[model samples]
Target: MPLGKGELTTTATSLHILELIVDHGWVTLRGLVEETGLAKSTVHKHLSTLRANDYIVKEGERYTLGLYFLTVGKRAVEFRESYQLVEQKVRELGSRTDAEVDFTVEENGRLILMFEAAGATNESTFGTGTEFFLHNTAAGKAILATYADSKRDEILDTQGLPATTNKTIQSREALHAELEQVRENGYALNDGECVEGYRTVSSVIKRPNGSALGAISAGGPAYRIDQSRLKNELADHVRSATAEVTESLVEAQSTL
Candidate 1:
């Protein structure tokens, strides 16, 4: 039997529906039809297929992701294994410095906050599941700065340089030059770029093969960070903590 182009397109649409469910958490059948611009019948058919595969589930009129995604996400993180280690190190860093430490992973063209911990002295208006602008945060720059020129340019082009604060980098040329400095220093620093009073310093978390896995950052108010006065002290602390986390990751990888 010959398979028609329409059938092939239908299969692709089904996969896209499942992906949308996973990405958006929950969506109504009507919303899926509107978002996908597919026929209502087509959307229903795809949703049924996804449900049959356990990739999605429906509760009354609403559909959400199912446990299959949990299994998939767990396996993916388990394969990498550094996610938990980095989380532990961030907590340790926060406790030792008495400041807020956050870890973020780059997924699907965005920085996803994976873990966070705050010490007694820590104060930053960020928490888990907070996604930040890739151009305006130290953690984001740390991950992006490690990317190849073309790859970085593509992201910048898509996201552009939306200013979060007056200090935010606006020009592509200026950001390009700043990323060059980050590459040279093996870390990135954002002094009130994301928020008026908040500052952060971060380094890329890399695999043994030098691929960027995520970033670890320490953030607090400008009154305390004072980069010019405390540059060496802060950098030394962050560098040591990052190194420790990297080493732990290496050890864990061996056991895998």
Candidate 2:
């Protein structure tokens, strides 16, 4: 069987409501109408369908995401065995380094933090389920560096580099150059680019098919993860974790 476009596509309104619910945790019907500016009746009808399908759960007047998504998300991870591989690797790396570690992948033109492990440090880092842009974060840049040149260019052309901090790369040319460095150095460095006081070192984790599984990163406060520490001390740990994951994936693929 070949892939075919759906002849009857669902409206985006229901999905919009789902996004709103996910973003704000629990939301009321009135809040949905206020934010979406849809007629009260329309919002009510859509939400009723969502609730009926177990896509959302309502307690009193507020609705939150239902357990259905958890099942679906877990299946997604099961399908991508690379996720399990990356998760265990990041956990071990975080324990040894005592810095924040995360495994991030590109999804819908943004970075999705799929797994996170906290180091001994009191300072926190990016958490799971958070989304970030490619041009500003070390993990994103490491993933981008492994992409085809044309694909990378097209994505940046559509979503121009939006700065999150003063240190964020502002031009495609600059990002391209930075990725080159990432390739040469085997890891990407984020020096307060994603946030004011955070720095990260990341390396792309490759799957057996030569496509990127995601990126593994170790990040901490800038004072501790400064340039010297990022390059000389932490980069190797990130690269080692990514390399080991890639090897396992490649070996698994060879058997198949």
Candidate 3:
């Protein structure tokens, strides 16, 4: 949730410190103070509290995130209703296509990678828990294509179409036009939009009611996944995988 007026500033400070630690890998008390511009005593107190709670580990003067975060992250992934099915399909798609496969869902108007399966090449840098904008990736576009215009516009308004690469769609009108094609094609393509020299193909997974649940994507280096292969082969592979996952999700929901 967005921070509201009169919310606990202390909690926000603690989370901000944690995020800094995550971004930098490890940090010292002085580093946190410098980064946050908070008083040294305040930073020390938050660090001490987090260390006591096992949320961070201290090595000499440096602190890193603790294994407790891993435990919590595991529970969060398993808590998703479609995680199991998505996991299975991600693995299968990776093996079948020899490209990195990812299953992503929208949270707070951003795409979050929920599950990922490394391809044989192991060249992909993305992993589970990676968060990115919805206008720069094939998976995000696939999900956006499935959303109602009002819902899609809301997310776009909240998270403006920032350009990641020169090829990224930066205008709402242009994105809407591509999304229309994505709807008709049953898949979305990312041709060096998010990361230059990389390409991706994705298809949306839908719930029983036909609302988008998430998206499944396969991506690789542009040379390996050239335009022809991206449109025909990889697109088919991603669409097939998403179709299977959507079918299984619908069946499971019906039983429940």
Candidate 4:
């Protein structure tokens, strides 16, 4: 039996809504309407379809990714070669520096923490599976610095460079200047910018294709990780870790 045009359109809209929700967890109906720019009735109808499909679920008045998303995300993590190598690098960095290390990747214009390891003496403000605005973190800055001007502009336009803290780089111009420094310095630093009293240094890991696979960050309390240490010691360690992980990735890819 052939489906009617209205039914097909409804199905398409429902899929689109599900895509948005899966990418960003917990969105209000108003937020969805604004994000999709669809009429309220249309958005509601699509949300209903997505709810029925188990692709999304409502909590109070907000909608979020469902069990299905967890299953998929887990599968994606399992298949990612970068995650495995990055995890090893994180552990090594943590053990060497006595600091917390995180492996982050930029996905859909956001920094996703894929894995984390903490040294015996380390403490940190962030945890595993945490996500951050790509324009505000050391990991994000390192990754963005590798891209060309047009690519960097496109990424900033999509991510919007939102201010997460007073210390965050709020203006695109400022972020651009920061990225330039990252390129010159061969690493990036977040000096209590993402969160007060916490500092981090990071570097990018590139795939064989020269695209950013992810980043490696070494972080500790601001008292121990001062501006001077962040610029010199932490930055150097993170860059070495990044190189180690990328080499492992390249070797693994060659075997496959």
Candidate 5:
């Protein structure tokens, strides 16, 4: 049977409610109705269904996400066979560089933080599972640089280059030039592009077949990561870390 438009709309509405609950931490039925601009009756019906499924919990007038989300998130991470090795390398890179380290992957044309390790000097404001625009981040660029031109163009076409800061690349031609440099250097750099007063260096991790699996990054305040260090030391460290993970992934794949 063909699915109707009403069913699709209902599914989207339910997911939107869930996103609102995540953003606000806790929400009231009235709050959801107001935020969504939906009728109170419509909001309450969705809330009732979610509560019955244990996806949310109600305390008096407020509703909060339930432990079921944690269960699902954990399973999602464990399902990635190389996640354990990736975590270990990220932690090691953080310790060695004394900078915030992150492992990220592209999903649905956006970047998702899969693992992170905080250093003494820098603690990440964005946590695991946070989504970020791909064009403005070092990990995103590194992953993009490893993609075939056709694949890269498809993502760029779908997700238009939106600027987050004045330093962000807004033109496809300029971004393509930068990605070409990333390919030549085996790494990428973000200088106050995604966030002001911060900089990052990243390198891509490859699968056994030489395709990009993801990217790893090291980032910190601009004052601490000067141009010299960003280009040489941090860039080299990130490349080394990614190389280690790529080799480990290859070895693991061989065993399978």
Candidate 6:
């Protein structure tokens, strides 16, 4: 639902129910009723529609997300030339640095994982469809820096920054300060913000007008990325990755 919108269309209600099902994996109509507070009749009606469309699958009484989304997600990834180009770069970066690499995008105001590659050294905690805090992770913060002020405020107002680790930025003022630093440095750093022992360096891939296309990151255990390495070596790799991805995307767009 859009912020400050008190009325929810039945379709929106149904979509919400579907999203809940997607997040929970499997749920009963009764469970949906309890979670959504929708009447059994309303929930059943929506579930019937969903099941008929193959958006949800039913087994006895439990409902699971349908396979239709698998095709859709695959097609979507292929449709975005950036994903293909970025995936190769992410994999290359991961293989070279032996650090977990990720490509993340802001969609519907959520920082979502688009692609992930485990480094030979094994250092990140991201996977496809992972939605993370915009104020914490390096990828999140890098993307956040590109959002307009009003849009950024709307996101923060909707998704309040919460402490994931002791080092996570909790205050809006602090986050703003950090975003400024990200702009100056052309990259962002995550020093045990999302996970206690993890660190990351990220840079945003931006379009010509300076809006972000997404962000790319290299992350690993804090022991593997000390402050000096985070600022220097890791930052260099992340900047290069973002530059390559952005340049490829611009070229692809020009061809289109």
lDDT score at residue 133, model 1, on the 0-100 scale? 80
Q: What digit string (tens of lDDT, one per residue) describes model 5 on residues 1-256?
A: 2345667878788888998999999999988888889999999999999999999999999999999999999999899878888899999888888888899999889999999987766677579999888899999999988888898889989899888899999998999999999989999999989999889999999989998889999878897778888889989999998898899888988988
Worst lDDT run of 10 residues, candidate 3, spans 118-127
lDDT of 5 at 117: 89
What lDDT tens digits, residue by residue, belong to model 3 across residues 18-123?
A: 9899999999999888878889999999999999999999999999999999999898877875888788888888887788888899989999998888777666
Clashing pairs in 4: none
What is the lDDT of every predicted structure here? 0.80, 0.87, 0.88, 0.82, 0.89, 0.86
lDDT of 4 at 140: 90
User: Is candidate 1 or 3 superior in TM-score?
Assistant: 3
Kindly give the stretch of ten consecutive residues in candidate 4 with the minimal lDDT sum.
Answer: 1-10
lDDT of 1 by residue, 1-256 (tens): 2345667766777777777876888899999888978789988988888888988889999999888876886677678666878877888888887767888887766787878878776665686767788888887888888888888878877788899889999998888888888888877898889889887888877787778878888868877767862356555666677777777767777887
- The digit string of per-residue lDDT tens for model 4 on 127-208 reads 7678898788899999999888898888888778677678988888898898999989888888778887788888999897
For lDDT, candidate 1 versus 3, the one ahead is 3
Scanning candidate 1 in windows of ten residues, the lowest lDDT window is 228-237
Compute the lDDT of residue 73 as modeled in candidate 4: 79
TM-scores for every predicted model: 0.78, 0.89, 0.90, 0.78, 0.88, 0.91
Q: Which of the two, 4 or 5, has more lDDT?
A: 5
- Determine the backbone clash count of candidate 6: 0
Clashing pairs in 5: none
How would the candidate models be sorted by lDDT, starting from the highest?
Answer: 5, 3, 2, 6, 4, 1
On TM-score, the leading prediction is 6
Cα displacement (Å) at residue 201, model 3 = 1.0
Candidate 6's residue-wise lDDT over 1-256, tens digit each? 4433666587788789898997899999899889888799999999999999989999999999999998989998999766788889988988988878888888876788988888665745756888887899888888888888999999989889889989989899999999999999999999889989988899998875568989988878877778887789879998998897777777877887
Candidate 3: the clashing residue pairs are: none
* Cα deviation of 245, candidate 1, in Å: 3.1
